[model samples]
Target chain A: MSHAIETIDLKKNYGSHAAIRGLSITVEPGTVFGLIGPNGAGKTTTLRMLLDVIRPSSGVARVLGETPQAGGPALRRRIGFVPGELRLEGRIRGRALLRHYAEISGQVAPGAVDDLADRLGVDLNREVRKLSKGNKQKLGLIQAFMHRPELLVLDEPTSGLDPLVQREFLTMVREARANGQTILLSSHVLSEIQQTADQVAVLSDGLIVAEGDVAALRLGRIRRVRASFTGIAAAALRQELDHLPTLRDIDIDVTGTEPVRLTATIDGDIDPLVKLLARHSVLDLAVEEPDLEESVLQLYGSSANGRNGEVRHG
Target chain B: MVRVLPVFRRSLGDSWRSLIGWSVGVAAALLLYLPLFPSIGGDGEMQQIIESMPPELVKTLGYEQIASGPGYTQGTFFGLIGFLLLVIAATAWGSAAIAGAEESGQLELTLAHGVSRSQYALESALAVLVKLLWLGLLAAALILALNEPSELDVTVLNVLGASKALVGLAFVSASLALLVGAATGRRSLATAAGAGIAVLGYVFNAIANQVADADWLRALSPYSWAYHEMPLSDGPDWAGLALLWGLGAVFAAAATLLLRRRDIIG
Candidate 1:
């Protein structure tokens, strides 16, 4: 199959409110595709429809080159999934739970589960219900990753994980992609997707606002940069930096007429801004990574929604 | 080659404790009420006491014939206490299998694997049937054990017949519960629907016994279909048993279909 996943005019409605409005995207096989959006942006809805956990109101989704309903259980055998809102409750120990899951999802080599558990450092001997949230998340990861399915669809996979474990998870993702597996993962955190995804689709308000290569989207991402200078007046600093493209909302403050402090959001590369500041005696600089919603708004706020490297599917 | 019905296996694993508890409960109810037949059974003063009550009340209670051996067994265990115990156990198992798992997110996770919707529901149906059968067989064995000791003269064939009828009746209730639970994904709603079927059936049968105009209700009530012939004393009602079994099958089928249509809510 040329595309591991493809959706055309995908739509879902919760009563009168349309949760997903005509979503369309295509992911090449053997690549990491990140679906990034804030909560309620319909990212979960789109991913769930692909997994056939939720049916679409209209349009079609083809995964692994088969319509989900036509593929049925046979198609799902080639997939591994982790729900966004995970709830696992049982009196049985985690090891038994994992074993049971493996038995249901086709075959797994002996010790496959144990190996994953060891890597995740999750104690599978404890009862599933009694384990902490992070531990339960680890167990979820092990189950999804153990089978080594052709397509892995994970939603908010690192919500409850510590940074160390999250790093380990990204490593696993990298390794999975290297093995020619297609990964479709959803996240509200920009950096998570930036670190693992080869291609990214930014979703907002039930629409794809931007889609492109990770580096392309990175350049399009808006960051609020604050800098202080001692040699230039606030007006002169604003005029000089303003000439450099990709800057907006320039706010400057001069308290005691000593150092000029300027705060503004830059849409594209910060390299030009840095070179311009090198000529002045720079004091302090703080650049902030906007949260997902802010970043999405900033993307939509610019021409990047179309001509700015946004990939259009065929 | 396949997973050996792995979904069914795991469901049973999760259900063993509750199934055992229910079996013990049905057995205890039978053991408690049957042995007393010796002291308070037969057509002597006990019949007078039953007669002294309001005619509607005696008929409603199914105490019209408590003197004969088979009559005493039917009146004490099969038609009354044991049926209640068995139906309660069935409904709980039925509702918990699908609706309970749905609420806890276990259903979504298991279902997202290679298990098809129909396959999962069918396996759940199998689990429900197997668990209910455990209680049914245990109830039959307990009553048979007390048959001679309690002066119950029920024939072995008739005892087994009545056990089958009781199980069939409970199966209808449990399947109804499973159907509603699968459709709604609400545990409380499904449990109520399951228990409602049995409760309404029992109450309708009682009302039909008193009100002559309500005779047609007996045909609609699974409870009446099960005990109308008093299978313990008069032999089994094969037609009625068939209807009960048939209705349970329809409900189970409908449940599987409904599960196939809805989304798996986490």
Candidate 2:
């Protein structure tokens, strides 16, 4: 079977400014593929090109074994899309808007929209304009997923969603994958993609700067830790923590004198650092899920360098 | 199977409130002007007033014929006030269908479904037609209701024909706006284009009225094509109606072509 989406050297330019420069990636038929990038990273542009919503300046894009231009409405019917900026306007109820889309999609199963709405905890009876931003975003997701399309292209699908709803959305993605739907989900949140995406391509400056297995990237990702101590000296603490096997980028400070803080970003196994930290009289300890965009850039930026799918422009 | 003309249906559905407003406004226009023809029209006072006014002003405003029923109808409504109302409505409809929707991100989401771009453009045009047709029918109905009472001696068929011509004239504006919206994806620009066509046509006609040698200008002005034959009084101008509709179709086709070639940046 052909790849679900295959773009070879595809590029897009708006005037003289290039939005997507020679992006190439192959997505398999039944997995969650994440397009990870920042706001102007060309992620949305690449997705639009695949849908033929935007024309690429150059290169080849074959979606479901057909060029997007030639595939036309037939290809679009197989793919569900949620735009990056969801704008749901109208005095009609959210359910009615969904019904309108369902009629347009035609392939939507009966009760599919209601099911998604229930899962997302959004009321369909509310007028679309009266809906909260997050609720509108949920409606956007419902319209896209209600059809159970073969390929789903979601851009920043969870941006306005609450944490609970976002978790449910990831579950929906997983369930869709289990049902054998191929997904091309794009977002700036690394943890969002890390939780659900099987393979990810980190896009930066209109190019795929890194592409790799999500599992490998996850294992290779750095964890940030902040620990406050009762009596540990800053210099002595760094000296002791530096000997640990996996910790790197260690910072020990307090802004004053008492309760010196030890903040370190570490990669690999955490057992050695945990055991060493136990030796100190720890006061306040907090382990944060690293900043989404920062952690993502670090993982895809440094480690995935010189790997497959990395593009460079002079 | 997909619903046929969902875009058309949704667009009309979305504007049902606005449609009602336009209907009421048309009814009000009929109530305001047609019933007063007895006092202002056929009394010779109105005709004398026109004769006393500058000849250029009378001709430019088409008020010279206010002494007659059909002429009063054309002067007060079809050629001026009523035409403006309908053209404004049509222009808003056309601009919103493409450029406004695209700007708000509605068009992209809709297009992401199974609907083709060409189909979207075609259906939007149909939606505009359906809307203008609704307003036209309301005007014709109200005008016919007053045809006898207001001494607007125009026949029922003639009133209907004039209304049809009015719809066609506004349709040209709507279609041109739709074409611009598709090409540029800018609502303001589309509005300007639609209004520009209506103004250009009217200016052409107005200028031709002054210059005796500018009878040829009538051929180029869409306003002339719709009104120069005096369809309200003489009879429906089949050639003029056909030209108006033909221009509408050309613009619609151009819009579809432009949309099919470019990207929907929204």
Candidate 3:
């Protein structure tokens, strides 16, 4: 499949510190691809490099088949960008900025910007500095989408937005995806990506830890298993259960502090524990499936070491 | 380009404040000119006052032919006013074209829309052209109104010379601001440099006029070239005017090259 955006060993350095190192990812055309990471994980820095706003120290990146650094005006015309911290002219009204942006982007519909503003509930007449954070985000989104660009690069797009507006924004993103627009969205928020992204790449310490189709990445990563036991004192049983090699942690208070407690972790493909528990007097046992949050945390979350879905902490 | 219209429109919109500010300067210049008009209208003290004034003061006011009846009104009266007008016009155009955009963060957004740094510089240069045209028209109207008497030929020539002078001066100012704006990220620094260049240009003009033998000094000041064009006293100095415009182009091109290399968002 032809990719809309791709980076090969992309690296960026700020003085002595590396914001992104040996980062590589491919985004297919017409798909929503998310770059998920914790704060300061170089997500925004990578986005800036892709948009040609920042230069990379090494490696190469291509946007729509053109080298971003040398790609001049012609290549930029095919892409739209929303910066992490958008600073617009304070004197100009929101509509004026939008109109100017559309005019500069070239070949956009007459009322396209106005319609977007209306739909986003952004008051275009208000000056940008006076607008609320959500309104400013709406303005930023309108500018990026108004030109109907082939590729949209948004950095921290839903910042300061209320949950309802964020939902609406995602709906807009879905509509864009339906129309065959490529999106490179970077966000620290988990639910935002889970609802929208078809593919996810988790970043940490300036490197991609894991990347794949969201379903494939989430399939085996999240762990949700609970077990209750008998024939042992409540405290002693909990203490003894912690010594088990497969089940390293057990929260006795949450698991009812009696002859029973619970342990959850990456399954490590161990079903013999269930068999061993069957031999014991078991009052109750539950093995709940893990959700996207658990899987994401397992992959990119700070607590997860640079391991392949091996989350030790329960 | 249609893309440039917004810069032009925004520049014009922002110019309203500068226009109001220049109006205040214009009022003061007109106040200074009012007392001299009577001297031109054949007042008794006209010759005595002309005889007593030092040549340095006359040179400062571009009053080479002050003994003539119309010289007082046409030369000294309008010359000082024209110089001040061009200064204000240039400052207004230059600041709006470059420093104002840097201050407002509009340059960052403007450059993001497939608009290259060179294109931004070109659009900004075009915006300055629009300002020159509008200000040229305003000065022409005012000059025409002030010169509605019998000597229409001389009056028209003087106004035309002033118009050309203002255009050249605006170029110098706009180009200087652009160069500073491209080099520095802060708007205040660009504006301060622009204003400093303008005041220094005026000083150079004064020095060159007082010491006419100082040909090197005259060549150094953009104003000196236009000052020699004195339509009320002599005729247009087309070569000097050409040189001023050439310098303006060079500065603007330098600004564009710098802008291409540096990051506007930074």
Query: In terms of DockQ, which candidate is strongest?
Result: 2
Q: What lDDT tens digits, residue by residue, belong to model 3 across residues B186-227?
A: 666666766676677767877877775865777777777666
How do the predictions measure up, each by TM-score? 0.93, 0.95, 0.77
As for lDDT, the candidate ahead, 2 or 3, is: 2
Q: Give the distance in Å from residue A270's predicted Cα in candidate 1 to where it truly belongs.
A: 2.2
True contacts kept of each: 0.83, 0.90, 0.48
Higher-scoring candidate on DockQ, 2 or 3: 2
Q: To one decimal, what is the Cα RMSD in angstroms of model 3 from the true structure?
A: 6.5
RMSD of each: 2.9, 2.5, 6.5
Q: Which stretches of candidate 2 lie over 4 Å from their true place?
A: A218-220, A254-256, A296-314
- In the range A1-314, model 2's lDDT, one tens digit per residue, is 99999999898989999787788899999999998877888888998888889988999999999999999888898898998888988898998898888887747877787788889999999999999999999999988888899999999999888899999999999999999999999988878888899898878778787677887655335788899987778888878987986788888894668799878888877888888889989888887667656765665575334343544321
**I-RMSD for candidate 3:** 2.7
Give the deviation of candidate 1 from the true structure as CA RMSD. 2.9
* Chain A accuracy as TM-score for every candidate: 0.91, 0.91, 0.77
Report DockQ per prediction, comma-separated.
Answer: 0.64, 0.76, 0.33
Q: Docking category for candidate 1?
A: medium
Candidate 1 per-residue lDDT, tens place, A23-92, comes to: 8889998999999988988988887888788899999899999988888888888898888888888888
**What is the clash count for each candidate, in the order shown?**
1, 0, 0
